[model samples]
Target: MKFGDMELYILSDGTLTEDGGGIFEYYPKNIWASYEVDGMTPYRTDEHNNILAAANCLLIRHPEGNVLVETGVHDKTLNYVKYHNIVKNPSLMESMKSAGFKPSDIDIVINSHLNPDHVGWNTVIEDGRLKPTFENAKYVIQKKEFRKAMDPGFELKNDYFSAEEDVLPLEGSGTLELVEGEKEIFPGISVIPTPGHTSGHQSVMIRAERTMLYAADMAALVMHQEKPRCKMAFDALGREECWRTKKKLLYDRAAENSWYTYFYHETSFSVGIIHKITNTRGEMEGRVEKVEIL
Candidate 1:
């Protein structure tokens, strides 16, 4: 997907098959199952009602430099992959290699948040020790998110389980750069705080004449972007705040500006433009529709 002078590539860390209950949480299965985007169901389900979602990351070939957004679940030795029955695919490194780039090619790595799945590739295990994966790239993240991940009380410990191994090592390598609130990492690429999934969750915006918003987990699925209320079980931390963040970014900004958007876990399709439309109930709704750029 070319954004004006820049090119955007969607690379998968892998696909995860999880129970619907874990994906939807409070959102009833029947209600979400009935909803479709552009006459196509957004998720693939099995007999056991497990949803297959893609852990997608974006690589931007920019004039300034190569930028990577959201590294996928990088830990295979972890018990969660076995406990949750996660189906691993080609890792972020392999995907990047297939895309004709290597670790040194990445100048910056923007982490939306420090969840295990999102920051897994920040470090790699070598010589029986954890070290920065992208040795030459500067790992950019929000300061608030770093502090929270470093000391996420007992209640939130599970979410940041890999932080000690994946993220903390970046600081030691002097590759970690923490910014507060909104800041532009490059001339046209910026990170905007879209807190809800986590206190410091953020989304990346690639701006040209039109903007492309990397919704990350803010809208993990196409359905989540279409209906902000239908949240994931992982959204337990700030469920209410998540909805508000969706409204602000998905509806108020993306839809209003018709920005091209990317959903991190949307397996079928990840990049598209958001459109606002009125439903039969006379309520305004956001629809993510794919558009061709001329």
Candidate 2:
């Protein structure tokens, strides 16, 4: 999809089937089951009622530089029980090749956070040693995020399991660039803190003719974008902060500016414009509407 002079490609690592109850946390199964966007459910459940979601990465082709956001889960990470049902189509590498580029073509790799699924492709095992997958690119991430992932407290340690192998290895390779707050890696591409899932979680923004917000896991699916209060069990670290950020970005910023929003785990209609709507109770809500790119 081309927006102005920039071409954006969604490269999916694969699908992850999660326990519906686990991802939705305390949200009642009956209520969440009724949720839909544009007549399509971004998630699906098998007979056992598990939520199957997609792991999508974004590739930006800009004159200034080529940016790859969210590396997607690596095959090695699939050994974990949670990822046992993961399905990879055109893996990140294959998808990048299909996009007319190689790992060397990537200028920067942006990680929204250091979660296992989001940073799995940061490194690849070569000669039985882990190495940065995109050898020529700088793996840009939040300094605070790196610190937390490296030394997480007991309660959140599970979330950083792959950091030791997939994330920390970048440091030794001299390919990691940790920044504070908001920083623009390219002229129009910047990362802003949107902490909820993790204290250091950040999101990508593409400022073109129409701004684009890669909400990442902050709005993992359209359900969260359409209803800002909807949160996942993964956000236990900063649930309230996450809700506020969602309200501010998806509602105040994206909807107000008509920006094209992208949710990482949304299997259907992952990219759209969030329009503000008044529901039956006269409350302001967001509606994820379809978008077209030139």
lDDT, candidate 1, at 63: 91
lDDT scores of the candidates, listed in order: 0.82, 0.82
Clashes of 1: 0
Per-residue lDDT tens digits for candidate 2, residues 1-294, read 987788899887887777777677777887677677678665556777888788889999889888899998745754673554777786888888887989889889999999888887899889999899999999999999999999998988988888889888898788999999999888888999988888899999889888988988887878777765677887846667887888877778887777889877877766898778878888877788876543
* Residue 37 local lDDT, model 1: 61
Off by over 4 Å in 1: 291-294
Shift of residue 50 alpha carbon in model 1, Å: 2.3
Q: Candidate 2, which ten residues in sequence have the lowest lDDT sum?
A: 75-84
TM-score of each model, paired residue for residue: 0.93, 0.95
Residue 276, candidate 1: how far off, in angstroms? 0.9
Error of 2 at 256 (Å): 1.9
lDDT of 1 by residue, 1-294 (tens): 778788988778887766777777788788766667667776646888887777888999999899999878846455878655565577778889998999889999999999887887888889998888888899999999999999999988988888888888888788999999999988899999988788888889889889988888777777777775767777645677887888887888898887888877776677788888788888777788875533
